[model samples]
Target: MLHLRVVCPAERTEDVLRVLRAAPGATHLVLLRGAALDPVGDVVEAEIAREATDEVLSELCRLGVDHSGGITLETIDTALSDAADRAEEAAPGEGADAVVWEELIARTGEESRLSVTFQAFLTIACLLAAVGAVTNSAITVVGAMVVGPEFGPLAAVAVGLVGRRWDLVRRAAFALVAGFLLATGVTAAATVLAEGVGLFGPGVLDQGAQQVDFVFQVGPFSLIVAMLAGAAGMLAMTSAKSAALVGVFISVTTVPAAGFAAVAAVLGRWDLCGRSLAQLVVNMVGIVLAAWLVLVLRRSGSSVGGRGSRGGRATARREDNGRPLAKG
Candidate 1:
């Protein structure tokens, strides 16, 4: 369930009330007329079922409430009311399976941006993985995996492809490419500096007796693991089951491969460096491809689930026209 707080202009309050009253999945409606001070409007609140949220939000957006007033949606973690149960039953599908597209797009937009924090996390993770590669420590590699933030932009790319938003696709792709290049370059510089302090030997890249050789080794299993991890990561992101992200992080080798490549370059191990580069590319391609496929499947399910609604066709028309279908 979602708790919605809508600020409606004085003249548009009736339209807002009608939208809420018409939605069978909306309950516990409350209205405080002329209560808003800053924007100066009526404050309307209601609890809405997740399955019915998209259409209702689209309607509200079409009414120009977003431009004239405001609408805020919040998840209700614990609503112990019979009204809520009835609302859920009145909705068409399971709440967990529903896709709140506005929310998803907003979230991925923020995550995919090439910001300072993104750069810092990527560089730091790569550096940590480089240390792990030099020491041949599996523990350190896992730690780097847990710290990497590359999944956000990758997931954004998948979302962009599904939504047909080429701008989002371009931004995410640029962020991914530029981020990895910057991280690898920084890691290589760090390796050179560490060697100057006598922390790394010229023979550090020796393949024999290495415990974490898997970091630089690409095989069929690398593609398989990346594909599985990509699907799981998409599920975790969309379903709000964030705990599963830790498992997804540890299952892929992109960060470790980048770190290993950087370290190998510093040590003049061209063979290991080339292999690590290949491993990095393979993992990234596998992940993006798998994520895109998962999104296509989910989007198909959402269309089928919404097909029976009376207003579904109208909503689809609005979406096709690039009109205000839950804009922003």
Candidate 2:
């Protein structure tokens, strides 16, 4: 459910009240008149059902109440009264099934912008991955994947493709490319320095056990795994399921592959470098394609009432017409 707090001018109080009273899912409407200290108006507090939230919010936005005064709505865990039940019952058919793209973008934006702390974490993760690859430690490789922060930009890119937002596409692509390059460069340099100090020996690169599999040796199995992981990753992010996201993180080899490639390059082992680089590309292509397909399916199934739904339909139409989904 959601709680809404609306403050409007006194002159518009009755009009607002009338709208709320007639609204499909509004309940526990309380009006406090003459409550403003700044010569504005009154405040209306109400509890609403989650299913009916979109309708009510749409109505409020349409009424210009948000601009004239202000409208603040927040999700509430507990029901305040029996009216809440009634509100749910009164909601429109099947409720709103829209994707809420703006909200999704905002959420993804928060994830894509790498902070100083995130950079530190990513750096540490890449370093660990490099060390793991050189030492043939699967445990360290998995740990690095858990700590890697590459998924955010990847998710952004997926969303951008589905939504056909060129700006988002550009930003996401830039972030992904720049992040990989920076992480790989740093890890490679570190590997070289480690080799110089005898912390890692030339034999490390020659060990078959330490080698990562990468080649046209790729098959449907690799594609299937990547596709499933990508879908699961997107689902976890959208559903706000953190634990599921952890599983999704470990299921893909993006970070580990990059680290391995960088380490191989530093060690001057062309065979390992080629294989590791191929592995990285395979994982990336599979994940992005899978994520895009997932989003496409989601947009197709979403309700067509909200702006998000409209955007989705538009993107679908574009795809149907052979227009590229992602911006270059």
Candidate 3:
């Protein structure tokens, strides 16, 4: 369930109330006229079924509430009311199976941006991977996988493609490419410096990294694992089961491949470097492809799960042309 807080203009309060009262999945409508000082209007609050949220938000956008007033949606972690129960039952589908697109797009947008924090995490993850590769440590490779933030932009790319958000796709792609390049370059430089300081031997990776050799072993299993991890990651995100993210994080090998590639290039092992690059590309492509496929399936599913959301996005997109599906 989602708790909706709406600050509506004085004249539009009745329209807002009517929409809420008429919505099957909306309950506990409370209206306080002239209670909003900043917007200087009325405050309306209600609990909405997650399955029905898209339509409700779309209607609110149609009324210009999002532009002129304000609307906020919060997840209700522990609502014990029978009214909330009835709201869920009255809605189109189960809450957990529903996809709240606005929330997803907004979240991915922020995560996919090129920020200082993103650079730091990517660099650190790559460095950890490089060390793991030279030392042939699977544990360190796993740690690098867990520490990597590449999934965010990768997810953004999938979400953007699904939602027809070209700008987001471009931004995410740039961040993904540029971030890996910078981190891999830094890792390569570090590898050279380590050799100069006698920290690493000249032929450390010549033995093919016995334990962590899988990082550069590009093959069918690599793509399959990445695809499976991508699908699971998208499902976890859409269903709001964030705990599953840890499993997804430790399942892919993009970070480790980048680390290995950097170290291999520094050691003049072009063969290993090429294979590691292939592994990295395969994982990235498989993840984005699988994630996009999952989102498309969810969006095109049955009315019991996709009715309000599908229609709402279509409706809102039509009404508010080129505005990111109602622009909330």
The TM-score, computed over Cα atoms with residue i paired to residue i, of candidate 3 is 0.90
> What is residue 146's positional error in candidate 3, in angstroms?
0.5
In model 3, the worst 10-residue window by lDDT is 319-328
A best-first ranking of the candidates according to their lDDT comes to 3, 1, 2
Worst 10 residues of 1 by lDDT: 303-312
Candidates in order have lDDT scores of: 0.81, 0.68, 0.84
In terms of TM-score, the best-performing candidate is 3
Expressed as tens digits, the lDDT of each residue in 52-98 for candidate 3 is: 88778777867877666777788888889999999999999888888
Stretch of 10 with least lDDT, candidate 2? 319-328
Counted clashes in each candidate structure: 0, 0, 0
Q: Give the clashing residue pairs of candidate 2, or none.
A: none
Clashing pairs in 1: none
Query: How would you encode candidate 2's per-residue C-alpha lDDT over 278-320 as one tens digit per residue?
Result: 7777777888788788778765554322334444444344333
